[model samples]
Target: MSDIYDLITKRMDLLTREKEVFADNILRSSVPGEREKVIKFKNLVTHGGATPKAQATGLKSTNKNHLSLSTHLGSTRMTTKKTDSDVSLSGNTINAEDQLRKINDATTKYYEMTSLYQSYMRRHNTVITGR
Candidate 1:
């Protein structure tokens, strides 16, 4: 349905914003007194008389060493905040390696959403067109 497509587009947009922020941080890693920006997602209540909520299922990290990915579940927008990462001798709060890792994660998520969108389109077409 159109709702699914809209959701996919919105999520892709969020990932794009995330990538831009991480890229900006990487670019400013050498600048003094520059603090890294982090994007956080918050839950919002969509008023429709408050129907009973269903249990949410999502990916979880089983190992302590595994890299944790942001879910951004049920979030329509993101809020940017200064990161608490330790600053280097140059007084730059951005860690290039960490930024790169975050960028990679965002990029991965973007592609995954793209793939899901394409798959949904295929299914939709199949349903509509007797193929």
Candidate 2:
């Protein structure tokens, strides 16, 4: 169980790094207008929530999952643009979006797993300590 915990922690750390990398790539690949649009979309998605100010801060989100919602929003926008036009999507943008999505999905899974492990540990400790 300790080994499993260690593995989960490592995976979570890796996912965090991966998410950051993808977010950076998405931001780098986006034009100024596209960036603005993505920020607006992200704000709308997270509107009236705890992180309403995320839009003004370089597309960062305050969500606990450590996944950057901006990347997903940008990806959606890129897909829409591609669909609206007859031209093929830029490979770099598509790849970055795909990577971001995969990283976000993995981050969510690892976060849930880590939470469950922590809960189990707390229960075990409570039984052992009888407190």
Candidate 3:
């Protein structure tokens, strides 16, 4: 009877340790994923532009005189207007700045969770090793 009771208690302790280790692993793994998202969103917030390829094509034309001076000036004005409107529309539709903010918040939360997990692991190890 004592042998059976001891076996059951050891198994329960093993399972509890496994659960704690699994939770720590999950917290550790999630940090890198969140960091990647934070980097991607930061790039989008900093460098993402709303200008279309068609407008860029005009600027990259090989032929210098493909458009008359007046027409070129008009095109430039229109491109500026289009770019402004596209920026406003993108701000409304995608809200890259807000998305970046949320990503930053998530990254901070992940870091905190990982730090807590590390602290728990250190405490567990100390208890297990008696050092």
Candidate 4:
């Protein structure tokens, strides 16, 4: 169903954005007065939430060993906000421990979502090919 695929794609997009934000936050943890970036999904609902269709003009990998490049689907749904927790001694709002934990969580969610997508495709293939 298109709706199911759209939902899964949106969720994966959100997770990807979360992971990126968390990674960035960890990198800025040591910088003085650097506020951590966070992902806010509430506004995404109002912001055209549709996934942009992929362009047909991109380069394609013609060989098994060819390097594959990733494309960003659209603008991120991330928003910056001050952390409510205590800032570090260096005036950085990012806590490395928290960022690491968030990154792990996002990674796990992404993996699960991908697995589900794969399972769906496998079933679809089986039905279509009768193999």
Candidate 5:
């Protein structure tokens, strides 16, 4: 009972179904990260309740004769270190072996997926809308 146009529409439905399945899986698998983020931000916004503004140049205890103040003043000492005459640095470099392995793995997967999709399109050319 199905003619060429009906077959084409049917094949389109197949592609549409596959697309929907992939989309539904992604949606169902997504964790409640958005809800968690909204709750965290709301808590942060509401947590700062009725705090008076602090003045600049604030001093603790306001007692200069305090033993703690003397100790704090004595602790603020400057130190001199040897200046480097020549600059030398070793930057973090990627391991060549690992880099090559990843490149090879990604290239193989890309080609495999590309070939599969190409084959599918070719086999279903008559049913596909655009050549």
Candidate 6:
């Protein structure tokens, strides 16, 4: 079991380093690198994973996209709402909450992402160090 953990940890360590590099590339506004990082991180997270997310099911997606209730202007028809994504972490897909979260106190998403990252690092470290 420890040997398996060790092997996993080696791969995870490499993934972590890759993640850091990808993060730096994203920070520097490198789109291709950011995309590559997303793919690499996804592979690392899902490597030998047991369960599949709901969206990953073989059938068609059952989830429905929530439509915007936003009002329209004169001729402009304010349907196209765009906002700056400066507040969101690098590589996150943009959405309504991304903007509102930036405009308002959107702590849950940030907190959740932080907690997840911390947990990932903690587990990875524990597996590697065995302490």
Predicted structure with the largest TM-score when compared to the true one:
4
TM-score of 2: 0.43
The order of the candidates by lDDT, greatest first, is: 4, 1, 2, 6, 3, 5
- Kindly indicate the candidate among 4 and 6 with the higher lDDT: 4
Q: lDDT of each prediction vs. the true structure?
A: 0.69, 0.52, 0.38, 0.72, 0.35, 0.38
Compute each candidate's TM-score over C-alphas: 0.68, 0.43, 0.32, 0.73, 0.28, 0.24
TM-score of 1: 0.68
Q: Give the TM-score of candidate 6.
A: 0.24
For 24-74, candidate 3 gives per-residue lDDT tens digits of: 433443342221111122322332221234344544445755643222212
Candidate 4 stretches greater than 4 Å from native: 50-77
Residues 1-131 of candidate 1: C-alpha lDDT, one tens digit per residue: 79999789978877887888789878878888888776544332441111113223344556857544433332333343565558678777778998899999999999999999999999999999989
Instruction: Residues 6-73, candidate 4: write the lDDT tens digits.
Output: 67887898888888889988888899988878755554544344333322334444685754332333
In the range 22-127, model 6's lDDT, one tens digit per residue, is 3443354434212222233343354333123322443232344532222011011112123444424655333333333342332444445456566777888998
Candidate achieving higher lDDT, 5 or 6 = 6
Model 2 weakest 10-residue run by lDDT: 78-87
**How well does candidate 3 match the true structure, expressed as C-alpha RMSD?**
24.7
As a whole number from 0 to 100, the lDDT of residue 22 in candidate 1 is 87
Regions of model 2 farther than 4 Å from truth: 31-91, 95-100
Candidate 2 positional error at 22, Å = 1.5
Worst 10 residues of 5 by lDDT: 32-41
